[model samples]
Target: MTAPESGDVWSFDYLWRWQHERGETEGRKPRPTALVACVKGANGRTNLFILPITKTRPSDDRLAVEIPQIERVRAGLAADLRLWVMIDEYNHDFLETSFYLDPKGRIGRFSSAFHKAVLAAFVQAGREKRLRKVPRYD
Candidate 1:
């Protein structure tokens, strides 16, 4: 997919499955799977996807399995060890507050913040020679 714009539509399931399989192989923990339904704007970028909350042992039951996934995503994109902690904090906040956001602004502010956070993480990771940002299509 050409870089998503504001209005470009993408699938949630595709990104979710991609993250899940990638997490299993390259990650140290299990992460939640995602599925894309549709886009709400014209920017053609990453957007919200469903993450059904599930309670599991040794993990917070409120956030479901998303914490691991968010952390993995952060770590996968982290260039330096410093980002690990920062990303972890951001991940925690995202999972915790996502439910309280006004549905109307989620696509714009909250979703954009999530995407920006990940992008920053990846850029840092790439700059530190941790990984390369490969173009992917969903």
Candidate 2:
């Protein structure tokens, strides 16, 4: 399989805020996670920045982007359900050696426009000091 690209949604064992705070390194369950960025380090290791997608509505304190129906279909998500991409926080993992990311296969890719919007939102959150990075790799 080729290396993962931005906007590729995968079923990943995502660790939540509560879980991460309690010193838990493992995620509770597998969920749809969108690959927002892929950066290659000097050692040739790819660091994947992924955001979790959920049907749950974001709280006032959380910053998220609502997934359009067409975008949901493009990403191979359930079009019937209202989905939101949490941009205020993300999980960072290594594409090459992640125990959390198996070679099962990705759901699909989001449209370039939607994917760019997600990235923009994430950056804004970061600049506002609202972005949380949940490290999935030690």
Candidate 3:
């Protein structure tokens, strides 16, 4: 499979670490994530900025913007799926690191207008202090 570019949605084997009653445990969770940006590091490896795509609506609508069903379908998502771009939920990973990009998980690239809106939301989130981590693409 080729490297994912910005606006492309792919399936990822995400290591979800959470606190358990006994201790911390990790689970391999399959999730659809969007490649927000790709940056070349000093070491020459690409660093990927990614955000999770979800069917669940965020309590704060400002944190997430809904993708129209038709657009979502065009992006290779299920036609009946109600998807939202979770701008506030994002993380960075090196292209050669622990992140696993599943070939079968490739959805499709979002529209240019949607990409622009997502970038705008990121900026708004930063200004509103709603984002836990500010995207480095700025």
Candidate 4:
């Protein structure tokens, strides 16, 4: 499988496992996520850093960036879909596992401007101490 490039949107099976009010539970949820970075490891596997993309608008604009409806449509999403890139919801996975990049699930790449905005949001999150540090990909 090819490593997904930065700005490329792909469907991810995000495993949500956490200790809730009752006890620990897990769910495999499928969603579209933007590949923000792909770092090749020494073992020849690539580690993918990604941010979740949602169809719902974010309550905090400072933590998200809106992807224009037109751009979303061009990326193979619904024409009327309201998409937002959630910067705070960053996650990582190895290319050999966890991530799925089927052609049918790809939503295409975002514009350079949008990619920059996503990076800026990461910087903001770091400055606010919400994010420890931004991951570097070679």
User: Considering summed lDDT, which 10 consecutive residues are worst modelled in model 1?
Assistant: 84-93
Tens-digit lDDT string for candidate 1 (32-129): 22221224536544343332212233233111222334443442422222221111111111222233222322221114445444445534544666
TM value for model 3:
0.77
The TM-score obtained by model 4 is 0.72
The lDDT ranking, best first, is 2, 3, 4, 1
| lDDT for position 7 in model 3 | 78
For model 4, how does the per-residue alpha-carbon lDDT over 5-118 read when each residue is reduced to its tens digit? 877877765432222223423224668777777779899988777777777777753377788886686556666778887776566666665524454666677777777778
What is candidate 3's lDDT per residue for 13-121, written digit by digit as tens? 5332222222433324767777777778899878877777778876854477788887687678877878887776565667765335555677798887787788788
Per-residue lDDT over 103-124 for candidate 2, one digit per residue giving the tens place of the 0 to 100 score: 8758899999999999999889
- What's the distance in Å from true for residue 11, model 2? 0.6
Better of 1 and 3 by TM-score: 3
Q: What do the candidate models score in CA lDDT, each in turn?
A: 0.29, 0.90, 0.68, 0.64
Residue pairs with clashing backbones, model 4: none
For TM-score, the strongest prediction is: 2
Clashes of 4: 0
